[model samples]
Target: MGKVRKHSDSESDDGEIEFKKPRPAKKKKVETKTAEKSNDNTRDAKGDAIFALSNKRRVTVRAFPNGEPAIDIRETYVVNGEQRPGKGICLPLVQWKKLVELLPDIEEAITALPKKK
Candidate 1:
């Protein structure tokens, strides 16, 4: 039998020298001017609110995707003389329906609570 040959770092198992081809660097994502213009227009076209409850807190119900309803419940406050939108819960149509169904029980629970002094 022939003697076994040792392989070098740059050599393949068959003793052929290997050269690695340089790969192109990945390109970063850049937002185009057209994309920015579309986003600006979408921001300007705010959805119309169908129902609103305004007390100490403000809650609004608006239709999204033309027909589906969404409820946004948030606090009303002012900062630097400008009214700023408060962070709050947003319920989609299904969850909003569930909340409506549970309203009777919720009212009962609230009525059962002791009155504040």
Candidate 2:
């Protein structure tokens, strides 16, 4: 707790009456480990930004040595202590962006589809 000082300094405080105790100085903004963000982009040693879908699957932003950049949505497996990409599709950045933009429409379309028996 802090001491409540008198409003004797109100004349110099732009006509505002102040009777409350002095507050502590502000600290730097510190982000927590579990802070939620729209996108969580992290990179691996191979220079690929990996977004893990599961223990065995991930979506990665990759740039090939041929100068082609792509978004890889793939499953992975550990072989001899190294993670290897499994059967999945790689979309060009342009196509990936388009897909992201269409997600809302896709959801609506999914709801409109007939249920299978």
Largest TM-score belongs to which candidate? 2
lDDT of each candidate versus the true structure: 0.59, 0.73
TM-score of each: 0.46, 0.56
Task: Specify the poorest-scoring 10-residue window by lDDT in model 2.
Answer: 29-38
What's the lDDT for candidate 2?
0.73
Question: For model 2, how does the per-residue alpha-carbon lDDT over 22-52 read when each residue is reduced to its tens digit?
Answer: 7789975443232123455666766567787
Report the lDDT tens digits of candidate 1 across residue range 45-73: 25334232563355566676777787777
Best-performing candidate as measured by lDDT: 2
User: Which ranges in model 1 have alpha carbons more than 4 Å from their true place?
Assistant: 1-47, 50-52, 63-68, 115-117
Which regions in candidate 2 have their CA more than 4 angstroms from the true location? 1-41, 114-117
TM-score of 1: 0.46
